[model samples]
Target: MSSRRRLLTASSCLIVLLAVGGTVVAQMEAGDRGILPIDSTGTLEIDGIHVDVGGKDAASARYAGWRIAQREGFKKLWAKQHGRPESEAPNLSDSVLDGLVSSIVVDRENIGPTRYIADLGILFDRARAGELLGMSGEVRRSAPMLLVPVMISGGTATTVEIKNPWQRAWAQFRTSQSPVDYVRISGMGVDPLLVNAAQTGRPGRGWWRNIIDLYGAADILVAEVSVQRLYPGGPAYARFVGRHGPDGEILGGFDLKAKDSADIPRMMAEGVQRMDELFTRALAAGELVRDPTLITVEPPPPVEDELAAIQPVAQVPLSGIQIQILTRDDAGLNNAVAQLRTIPGMEGVGVRGGDKGWSILFVNFRGNNVTLASAIRARGWTVSDVNGTLRVVPALQIPGAPSGQ
Candidate 1:
């Protein structure tokens, strides 16, 4: 072979290798675009509603099915809330029902020529529904709990590392009805890196604390689902376990079976509901409390600057004195208020009213207005008497100079 031919062959191989590497990188990055959760925050939701209705056409049949679903969903909700039978639920007109219903989620649908058969989720306006149900508008929720859904399939455990049925089940679970305050994260961007299946097994509270702080959650809940398939595209069984905190203590576990691959979604959705029940029971029993070991309360840094500290002074023990603070913005007004509170003899301070331009402050000082004025002046503020009320102006901010010097 010629030297020139050998060089060309080497170059061709290098180009092919680079192209493959680029393709691999692109595929890896594509995994970051996971399914984002649909937020169904304050509404009362009823899921697993079965609707089947026939009409002149598909559209009409779907419409009829939805109307029927609303009626069925309301009955189910009423029965669940009042501990009564569906037959005993109040008969409300379509007009009244329309006012209360928020939205209808079609879980799965089959539209025939003149028939509509579907599983649906109905969301009702909590405030509106509460009136009819004799329930309160306010719902008591648990402290924020970070949900780490772990699914084990084909001998591999994964969480938000990739889009999966287990994660989707939890993301779609309506938390408004449940007392457990679930903090679900979209498995996108860096979430896959931070919250993987391995993170759940870690026994370190320090690492858990960082995760809690990042997600604004007080604790963590590890919901694990292990799938066992009997055959390809055949029956499947899933075992679910609810674990809590950094230690990953098991709260409860359950088993569910799916008829086929298509039924896996429904099974997962049901699993979510069952897991929620387990958590709710555990919470009421005080088993779902956040681990105290995870809490790291940093002591507040001490202030040692002379200006920041209030000088010791004799107390006069008198009533509050009225003062008007002059400022251009809320920051200036807040700074002025903070400074005034540092006065040695100040008992209490309250802002009565005012806009961004100014604020009316009532200062309860142990000393008289005269003494208070002297203390205010010492704190880089201009004080003047306007009738009986004292007027205070914050220290001027000079360019390239320290403020309140």
Candidate 2:
């Protein structure tokens, strides 16, 4: 073979190899490796066996157990890392940590007459919970009866006894105390009025001091008070007090100002809501608990700019062709220009001057015009024969710009 011919063949082979390599690299770069988009409305299965309490489905009985478990795990991990005694971990009662796991839902699926399995799904955050609840009427209409777990707590027990003889009789006469309710300490020899006064803070510290002195044998004191009025020097006052032991230590006391009665309930409710919010925040910050199943869905892969993939190739006919690209502004025009620069034989790809939006691509076509037009069309762009020139416009560009403008 002639040396000149051999050089030409070698150059052609190199070009082919480069083009093939570039295509493979681009394909690899564009590969997506993220979570597949699952339908928001999908079934969740929780291990039901974990929730058994007193012949009741554990989901209904232990409401925030998963959340508590997560929190406990976090505390345990923190204690290990900080070299703190695990026993010193924050003492969050089951009730206190219940709010963190309220979004967990459980379902029972029957495998046999006496056997079943529980499926669980927990909303990772409030937004996810809300979404699961259905963000719109259409979604809500489709999904209903999202069964969620409830958290219940058994409170700490504190024992108290009435040491006074008279108070003991009074206590014996009253009905039984309810669980989790305060028990009235009775049996102290102190006068009921004096007790009331101490409870109600009428006789004040002097009266309470005297009662404490008298109840030296008692272990805990209880006082109940009610207010009659607010402003300065009103007849409103509370006068119930009960002293517990020989030392007269006040174990529990109630304050009742007329103003407080109306606001206390609201304040209590607000406190409960605040606690719920705190738990939610703690869960979100990964401070209280971590659940491996509560994985956040990875975001979708970015869509490729279809127009930018159109490579400019040389040897394409451009006789009398005028290409004008209308972009939003210079930045957009610059982007378009950058993409155009990659096209072979396409030269002078520059942004238009002034605020008039557009980028211009001047191509010196030397390739087959038909083949070039087909490639542009395949990329969803338009090719037009204008004034005997082949004008190419990206589909993403603004419509209605006059040719050659």
Number of the top candidate by lDDT?
A: 1
Query: How would you encode candidate 1's per-residue C-alpha lDDT over 1-405 as one tens digit per residue?
Result: 101011111112242323564553332224553556666665788877888899999989988988898899998999988898999999999888888887777777888999999888777888789778767656678899999999999999998877888987887777878899898877776788788899998898888899889989999999999999999999999999999988889999999999999889889989999999999999999887778888888989997899768787675677789998776678877887888888887888898887646678898898888889999888877788877788777777433432121
lDDT of 2: 0.35
TM-score for each model: 0.65, 0.18
Which candidate number maximizes TM-score?
1
TM-score, candidate 1, is 0.65
Indicate the TM-score of model 2. Answer: 0.18
How high is the CA lDDT of each candidate model?
0.81, 0.35
Model 2 CA deviation exceeding 4 Å by range: 1-321, 344-356, 368-371, 397-405
Q: How many Å off is the CA of 352 in candidate 1?
A: 66
